[model samples]
Target chain A: MTIEYASIEQFYELIEPGLNSVELAVYAASITTFFALILVLYKRLHHDKLNTLPVNISGFGYAIPGTVLAMAMLATFGPLDNLINEWALSLNIEEPGLILSGTVFAIIFAFVVRFSAIANGTISGGVEQVAHSLDLAPLSLGMGSIKGIFKVHLPLLKSSIFVAWLLVFVEAMKELPAVLILRPFNYDTLSTQIYQLISDEQLEQGALGAISIVVFGLLPIIWLNKNEEKS
Target chain B: MTHLIDIQQLAVKLQNKTILSDVSLSLEAGDILGLVGPSGCGKTTLLNTIAGFIEQSAGKIVIDEKMQIDLTNLVAPEERNVGMIFQDYALFPHLTIRENIGFGLFNLDKATCNSRVTELMSLLKLTELAERYPHQLSGGQQQRVAIARALAPQPKIILLDEPFSNIDARLRNELMIEIRQLLKSLNMTAIFVTHNKDEVFTFADKVAVMSEGRILQFGSPVLVSQQPNSWQVADFLQLGSWIPVKCNGDSAETAIGSLTDVHTENCQTGKTESSIMSLLVKPQHIRIENNENVNVEINHVGITEQGYHYIVSSLNRTDLSFDRLSFYSHDVFQLGQQLAFEIIHHEYLMFDQAPPR
Candidate 1:
């Protein structure tokens, strides 16, 4: 990390050669998995202007056991990888696994399983509240009751989402298994970079990386919660 | 203009339990029929059946005679051109007033749908609310928009579950007047269902008075008031009870003096000695004694918290000594005050045990 060879080109060469499938898979899954999380969240929530990277990594980033979701993603992605390989063979192409594992498919598969559960829970909870407004049947009467909820239900809940996003953001900064198994080799996310430096016992450098990720996570949550509570 | 709806003996049984027992009625074009009853008395079930939201277990509902829809015959609510206004005014919250009205006119051409919505908005005075969603409006405004939305499609028949229940009491009368006028002027066959007797008298051209699960009386407001079929009907209509009177021909010998106007055949004429023959008298017919002819004493008096709204009657006559008569007067009377009057008219007439038609 400190340029032992005293040359930037040598450092770059040393970093680039040691990349393997495990690292490639992890980085690919992490970034694409983050995008997939955004997609699911976008479908469930439309009003929030907050970005998805902080949310995707922080909320369930560490909560999702990387081994289980990673294994599941591999199984799901295996068929698609084979199909891509067959197409590559038909076209006499050199790379097939690149299309399957190194691309967005592997990452999306892992994150979808996580976010779908969250989206389903959130949407259904809001819908259940609308159902009990009256004993009257659901066709229109139940749906009619949700309008008022849609308004006041927002500003009051902004603080909660902000806090949740912040806590999850910090957690994502420290996520281990998911960062280890999902990231692609060539990629260097903040979490993975910290893991690499820490693994080498580069204490000062690893500490710096860790501090940056935590700061990134906590700042938004505090700012949002404070501003919202003020309003 | 024509018969918009006709139901013949609508006997409905739900889960082996009878909900409606042999119900039948019809509405002509431009007629506003009011269906009145207590809660859970099958009024809403009847409306749901007519709207094709429920399949009756028995009987027939013929719309225009060509469509022989009945208890056995099933039809979806959306398929039938019956416009329904719910008690709570079920306006779609997600949609604006224009969209709500437009939703009903999906089958119409674009220009026609737009024009129809505009016309209905003007008709119901909902022009300003066309762009507003239901949550933005007050109860009265939401009700008007609901009416407008139902009217936009111009269904052959409209069903108003409870036209005034959701609106404030001060505005209920005005809304009733406007709704009645709208129904009449548009020549749309409709039904107004309510438990309030006053709303029935004001808003409906025909009324079906129901109790339990059966209609006690079906006729104009005047007939239902003047001549209910049984003692129960008379009582439910608040027309007072008929006391026991011995009659000779048309002249009846009873309490307060000999009565002459009642037909003798209407009373039990020839029965055993122990057979009970009861005479009918309304509270209004019995009066406070001001003259020295009859001795009277006030039992109780005071304006009730409910203002006596006159729905509840003070018990003036007992079964042994005094007779009851039906009366209509807005004036408040004190308890124990001596009131004197003659039986000028009847609140309702009665029939022998054979039961009236």
Candidate 2:
């Protein structure tokens, strides 16, 4: 088949809308929050009596199909919003209609639940690679455990933390099923737009967005290769 | 000698298994105590327990006549004021040598910390490598950095776990001597655990031999070597080979000959039943005899600076065959050749033989 390239002006017009979409903004914001939440949860649960269980529980989303995860989130939040609204009404306050299920919150929630394992696994592996003696070395030198972790472990885990964030960001960008089921009205991400175009038998029009996803996916691979070579 | 650290009946249990028990040890100020034992005899565990890394199940650890710890309360490792040098050095790889030495001094002002780091770097001969990271340095240099870091805080007591085990054999003794001098010059009280008994002779003021989570003997290196309290202590030290003997009151009969001057310090005099005993036979105590038909076969021979040392086993038809007794000879002897020998005049040390299963 002969492929026709879009003119520069037409290309700019086609790609600019996708880049400026509210779905992209939500993706960025949700992923930032998700990364922060992973750090907070990992830090809190790491040394607890539960050990890795809390992190593993959060990682359960990775084992389930994204479609199943989307349905589970919908099932959970759809009624939680109603219960909140019902309580608001009983208290004689204005009803906050579908506050969670009818907005970007549900989509972000699904993304976080599905991709937490990647962040947890990366950080946990990084933490494990550090010698247990290194953990106690600072303690012997008169530094508290919390301070020692910050001084010693966090600096050591810098690359791993960045890698985890990048991986989750890229994964969230390409997620389709969860976004498709959980997105509010009029919201469209790169993957959803590509999906919509393909469904309409106009895959050629969505080629640039699909290629962007591929380009993003190659980043960690190149980074890992560079690190291995450096080492 | 003022005691800097006193451990009273310290016992540790991990996950329902006893790791250390009745480990009572006392160290004077500026003294170096070597914890020598076979593998898995709780040497490292005792060090960790004293360092506050492991919680004790019973007894107390009293330090510098100040801090005290028992089962109910555990002073956090950070708050214990006890320093430790691990086998792997455990230097913060991300930090420079100067920074590592200054890590314990982080709470101090910048100038004071810098001065302390400089002082330690000079003391440990690491001033030239101060800018280098741990991985950039050699093993011995990294261990020096670990020592400098551990000492930066001026801990009341320092614990080292197999500190020199990773060094080259030729360099290990030199490093031990140098570190011993450094510790002595600084008047630092420290305890180091190692499986090498010779390290104790070269590096420690007092040596402890441990087995099955209990300290078998604790005394000066010379004292422990001169008089090992138990069979296990002498065996662990490998001070001498055992010569089986039949004990009859004050006298003992051996394969080499009867020992009329047997020392009964380790045995009871009025035993109703005769017992089989083993005499500690040092290599210097055995002398070559001119007689040819004595049935002593040279099992192995190796050249030493003193002479050719031969390990001869008794081929005598007597029931008391003393096997693998090391004897030093000025002349080389062929392996498996029969020779005559006699015990020189020496203080006899004998112990009851282990009961056969």
Candidate 3:
């Protein structure tokens, strides 16, 4: 129950040693964010004339619950490291975070999952504004919609980006089940930091993290709500 | 040459409700067709359908004769080369006025786009507001920007759906005058959908009178106003006196009197061979004629501030009939005064009780 951090030489007593470095990287590569990113990419980049997938998949209503998603994340990523290493070899990428895994990758994938509707809504609203003004077809006016996202759309999305940044940041900060099962070795985020601290009888540190999150989270929630009201 | 824009048997069914049905009309070069109807009568629906925003359930929409596409197979709204000003003018709040007008001209060369934007800004007198966002502009300014944006693409047919409703009513008439002039100078073929009678009369070359998803009449504004086909139409256009009548083949007798000038009277009652029929009379055709031998019993006289009195005449036939027969004049008459009135002339149009035979 007592974990030692003072002496770097005594690491073997407190660690799961048999797992090698490559095996550890593979373990971190599979999780909710990885799978969620797949759904998000399909939703965003699909070019079908009739788009019914994004909404259906955003799981605005039909999402598998978080616990089930956690279970799925574990099963999908836990034993699938060999396949990941094999695929990673084909792509010639040494690091897994570039394509999948850990806090940064999980956050990226989680964002696309939890926030695609907002992204699509923002994009569609921009298109609608131009379409209606020019009497253009909302569909036919899809002129470089992909190119536009980087050129004209991103500039126009200042407010959207700021809001989305706060959402993704906070969600990634507070995410538990995904982060709990997906952190790299010796990594301590504020969310997992609080959960681990509390479990180890450090309630004050945990409470401080919880309090900081509440204070920071409340500000963005209010701002997001107000932005929506104005929009 | 074919008309600039043509629509035939266009029906728009949305959310299981028939918003518009079999409404066919066309706009020639330089023609401004005003689609006038009461609220929810499909005027806006028809305009949106023509602009390609709403898909038509049936019928053909031809643009410039060469692009004859049944709206069922319509080119998309953006590619249709049509323009529109919505009821609210729906200006983009984020874009500056200049950018808005320049948006649809994205295909043009940069120089061409700039010149077109400049020309439209001056054309709409929006030069001062060019840097402002839509929310910063006044209703009239926003309206002009909307028009300028729509017009920048030089669309074949401009569709204006209740364009002035968002503007101040006091400014609407003056703005309409400016818009009408601008459209003429540009030789723009437009369909202006509005419910206001005066707006339609003053702005449109032709009018389509509609109610309950049906166009009662469509023609030059004067024709639709002066010679509406039925009582429903007469009521919609605020035309004519709805005189009660009983008629047959030749002569029709209304509350006012009997008339034998039967040209095309379809009486709902009486034998077709008989000379008695019921018909409606135009208000302008019924007048106070003391010397012409037509008797009118006045039940009440309503006076306006301008000293003119509208006489509400009572029918001796119906006893308690409020026939709503009124005449415009400055001479105030007393209530219950039996006045001598007569048929103004042959302009009194009589209709059958129910149409056909």
Candidate 4:
């Protein structure tokens, strides 16, 4: 088969899915990293051995393959969605069909579960580098714990949080298995669109999308290398 | 006047191990209490307990005569109105100096907060560095910012954990004096922890010597230095050398000399049956004799600001012999030189050979 360059119109056609992928990745990474930061702070400051169990559990998700995680999400949320629908039917109300299993929420949930370990590891290491006294100093100054975290810790953790977000975003952009399995019907991310083009033997058409994904993936590596050199 | 801070029977147990036990202390307003001890002796633990950073497993803490903290009625650190300066100063690296000092002033009006920040900046001589982050400043400057932040909220009491440990030795004393004057001017009651006894003498109005999770003695710096009540206190303070003494009837024999009327008044061994006691012999209590048997050989010599300091070991190879006998003199002494010395006739102070079990 001849490998002809795709027309500019075909490249422009991929922008919508590319933007959608960026948007989804941003939301999932932000939410996951925020919770990861809170979990880290709680584990460090509370000194509770039990708190570490949840952190360990969150990190265990990374060990699971993305395809397996997507399947697990479907297996878990499908039943819960059916139970909700059954309850609505019994009450003579309109059933929200496939609310979770057939929506973007499933894909986002799969991404969060898959990438939470990265966020947790990066953020927790950052928090550990901070002196424990930083936690107590604000408290001693009559600042409540929540406010102190936002004012004192979050500022100190800016670089770590940014790195975590970037890592998760890159991973989500490159992730095809989970997105292909869990993405809602009629919704297409860059990864899914590229997978479709490659499946249909239109490599030239998907080359632009493929390059965008690779470029996004290189962001965190470049940023991390720069930081390592600085330090 | 009511005590600004009162800790009664405070005990802290971490991970099933007792860190501090039955610790009690009281400080009136404007009082500076120094907690001095060896490493792992729980001085910093006591300071953290008082600051509400560590929960007391037993007893209660009263701050400003109103807030009482106990196991049943727990108060968070922020609500305790206690401020702290950590060993590393714990200054926020993200915030500028002005923002750091103004951190706790968030509850106040904007004008009041700005005014307080400005006031603390001027007071701490941080006005010029107000825009700089913690990493941009020197160690002393960071410490001043930490102090300013702690003082911004006008806390009921201040707790400092090894505040001067990170400071340059040359600047430590000067910083301590300046901070002491600032605390006194504000009439802010404070407790500071340090392993260095000299810091206590230079910085604290009262000194509490601690060992094994207990304050062995507490009093004015001079009193504690001159008349430590326990063997641990004297040994930890390096107040003097311990000379082994054996008591017989109304007299005691030492490696140095014998003393008549070795009554129980000056004896604090707490063990009546044990005849072996250790005498707390100060360096000034010893005098060189012109004609006598050489009883001590100089083992170590160093120059102090006052004069030459020598640590000599006993030449008499007997049960009563001891090492690390320290004294100072203007006359030079060789490292291996043997000398004759006698304990001057004075009030005798004796303690147990070891801490009371």
Candidate 5:
């Protein structure tokens, strides 16, 4: 058998479809925003009950296997997708079918379900590192609870939030099993494209895509090491 | 009108354990109250409850006799117009000194806020360090920034938790005096907690001694030292060593010698069989006698600014075992040196001893 890929340009050309996909960008942004909002809401609404069930359950996703999470997402959203499509057909909306499960929504939903724990854990740990007295300081200084969080806690957690976002972004970029199961037809993120190339025994063509995933995955490790040095 | 902070029967229970119980105290508008107690004695809990960090389970906390907080309806810390200086300073490490001080002044106009920050910085001697972060400042400077931040909003009351504990012991007194002057100049009503009783004398106008979630006594520092209401207060403050005595009506007989004019204010008035009582023997009240018989042996000795001080224990164990009396003089005494001393003429502060083992 002949190896078709000969140069870096060829590898780039083969993986360009995955790199330039708007759906992948949208999925990454969607998961990041969704996780951040959930983490902040958890902190604001139930700060006193941080160790309670609600917060712990929200962070439990980190321990879940990606394949199991993908299947769980499918089991929940697939039926809901059908119910929505049937309603749309009855309402005479032109061509509605499998809206959530058939598009990038499925992949984004799966990503959020699987990776939210990373963001929540990082942000929670950051919040914990701040002296509880600092939170009370703003309140004693004439700031309300919400205002105190915004003025004091958020500013202090800025670095943690950035690190959380970067970690989730990189993880999403390189995650394979979940995206492979949840991604709709013709939707190819870097991980999904590289996986398909390997499955087809054409890994040489997707070398640049695989290298990119490895490079992206190294960011969080480097960041954690730097933080370890700091502390 | 007599009180600015009127806490009536305030109680706080956490996780089924009572942290503060019926902690009733009041402070005048310009008075500073110092809370002193051993570790885990609920002093910090009381301060936190007043600062609105911990919710009270019962009773009421009234501010200026108008705003009252109780079990059912609680005022948030911000709306209560209270301020706090945490022990660690908690100076918003990410913000510069100016920003931290000006944080609470956000409600003011920009120019007004700037002027207020400038005034406070100069008053606190933090002007030169305005642009520096908290980590860069020395401990004392960070403390000043924390004070400025707490004072920025001009709250009716402020709470401080062991603010001087982090300072060098040598500089602690100087800083305490400076901060006391600043608070007095501002006419700020405040409550501070410290385990060190001496701090109450140097920093506070009033002292409240607490033990096991209860206030044992609340009075002027001098008053508390002179007359601690309970054994816990006397022991915690270390007002004087206890010399066991046999009570006989108004007077008591001690190891040093039989003494008249013993005050039994805390005991029953009527006569009864001789019972054990503890006589408060301060160092100043003991006089060294130049006599043939040395009645006591030096147990310990230490040098002080006034002179060398010695703790002398009774030589005869049956008279009173392990009972120590302190004596201070310019004359240096040798360790284990036998000394004869007599109790000088003074009114005694005596309390009944717990039943013997």
Candidate 6:
């Protein structure tokens, strides 16, 4: 079969999965980054051995193979789903089966666990650049701790937060193993679509999807380079 | 009148290490207290303790004789109604000058907040830069914004941690004078930390000299200078050179001359009769005695606004020898030149030599 010039047909076929990929990446990155910032703030304000526990555990996720992490996620949430279903049955209520085990929530949860270390490391490095006194200056001015963080810290961390979101978003877009194993039935993302076409020896048909993942992956790298140059 | 701030037996521990212990100080309304010490002397820790940033392991802090803070009744920093200006100024880089100054005024109505911010901006001569962010302003301008922000809420007492340290040395004195005058005009009670005793002399109504997590002395600058209570305080202040002397009855014999009618402070009663004592010999207390034998050799010479300044070492008296004897005169002296000098008759100030570290 001759490879034809790239056609819009392949691009048209990728629109649905591309949207799905964007949605998953956005949801996972937002939640992951939010929790990362909170963890950083907690560590800064409270000096305890336990402060590093959650970060360490989350960071450990990045070291695990994606397939293993997907299995772990299923193993963890699958039982919780069964427990909830049993409780519902006990109460004679309708069982909400597999609410977390094989849904978008599970995919997002896996992404968060897999990429939290990236967000935490980036945001933590940013927070370290800020003077510790900035944390107390607002408190001295009669602003509560929460408000002080919003007024002083969050603004200062804006670039770090953006970079972290971009990094996780890129990772989520290209992630294949975890998505392949955990994505709900009939729900296809760019990664899954690209993987399927390649498995079927129709790599040309998935060229647009593969290119889309690569382009998404380059965004944060380019943005980071520009920022490094600016700084 | 009740004191604006009364701290009693304040102590702080961080990571199982005691940072401050038995630190007590009181400041009246409108009085500016300067906390001066070498680095790691707990001046900043004391300030942080007062500002409620660091929890005290022991002791109590009373603000305006109304709010009392102790280990049992710890108050959060924001609710303490105290303000602090950090050494780095800690100005919010993202906020404009006006917005930074108005930050703590969130409790006030919009009209009140705007008025307060405007008034502070004018007072600090920052009206022209109100729209500029902290990073866009000069160090002095950023410091002024920090001051304005700390003062906006009208807290009972303000804590300033080396506020002028970031300023250019050439501008530091001028800025200190202006800020002191402004604080005086507002009748604001404040405590500022610095290692420069000169800053205290120029800006503080009261001075506290700290060493090794303890306040060695606290009094008016003149009083502390004239009657330093300990060897550490006198030595840290550079009040004078230490001349090893032996006390016999009412007089003390030194390498230079005998100081009669010695009045010793912090000198052990029985030990002073035989053991060596360090006399605080101010530069002005020494006079040239050309007719007498040369007793000191000039080691260092430098010019000052006062005149030729020389640091002389004892010539031959090893038992009573001393170095760094500061002397000022109109006559120039070469290094290594022997000179005749005698301690002028004055109220004697003596302290026991500090224990060796």
Ranking by lDDT: 6, 4, 2, 5, 3, 1
| Model 3, CA-based lDDT | 0.64
Which prediction has the highest TM-score against the true structure? Answer: 6
- Residue B173's lDDT in candidate 3: 91
Better of 1 and 6 by DockQ: 6
Docking class of 1: incorrect
Q: How does model 1 score by TM-score?
A: 0.64
In model 4, state the lDDT of residue B5.
Answer: 83
lDDT of 5 by residue, B147-192 (tens): 9999999988999999999999998999999999999999999999
i-RMS for every candidate: 7.3, 0.5, 4.9, 0.7, 0.9, 0.7
Q: Chain B, candidate 6: TM?
A: 0.96
Over 4 Å off, model 5: A1-4, A7-16, A20-51, A89-95, A219-231, B266-268, B271-273, B354-357
lDDT of 4 by residue, B1-357 (tens): 788888899889999999999888888999999999889989888888878788889998998899989999989888888889898898887788899899889899999999989999999999999888888999999999999999999988888888898999999999999999999999999899988988999899999999889889989999988788888988888888888887765678888777777665544343543377888889999999997688889999999987999999888878889887889999999999999989887667787665432
Which ten residues in a row are the worst by lDDT in model 6 chain A? A1-10
TM-score of chain A of 5: 0.81
For candidate 2 chain B, the 10 contiguous residues with the lowest summed lDDT are: B265-274
> What local distance difference test score does each model get?
0.62, 0.82, 0.64, 0.87, 0.81, 0.88
RMSD, every candidate, angstroms: 9.3, 2.9, 7.0, 2.5, 3.0, 2.0
Off by over 4 Å in 3: A1-68, A76-161, A204-231, B15-17, B71-73, B211-214, B267-278, B289-313, B317-323, B334-340, B353-357
Question: What residue pairs clash in candidate 5, if any at all?
Answer: none
What's model 1's lDDT at A9?
55
Q: Rank the candidates by DockQ, best first.
A: 6, 4, 2, 5, 3, 1
Model 3 lDDT tens row, A16-92: 32122222223222232233333443444443554547545564622444445555555665456546767778899
**Candidate 6 per-residue lDDT over residues B1-357, each given as its tens digit:** 779999899999999899999899899999999998889999998998888888899999999999999988999999999989998888888888899999999989999999989999999999999998888988998888888999999999888989888899999999999999999999999999998878999999999999988889999999999888888888778887778888876777889877776655434366568678777788898988867598899989999988998989998666888877887889977889998888988877776674242
Q: What is the TM-score of each candidate against the true structure?
A: 0.64, 0.93, 0.76, 0.94, 0.92, 0.96
Per-residue alpha-carbon lDDT of candidate 2 for residues A112-213, written as tens digits (9 for 90 to 100): 777878877777777777887997898899998778878998899887777777677777777888888887777777788788878998767778667767
Q: Which digits, one per residue and each the tens of the lDDT, describe model 6 over residues A98-187?
A: 999879888998899899999999999999999998888888988888988888899999999999999999999989998998888999
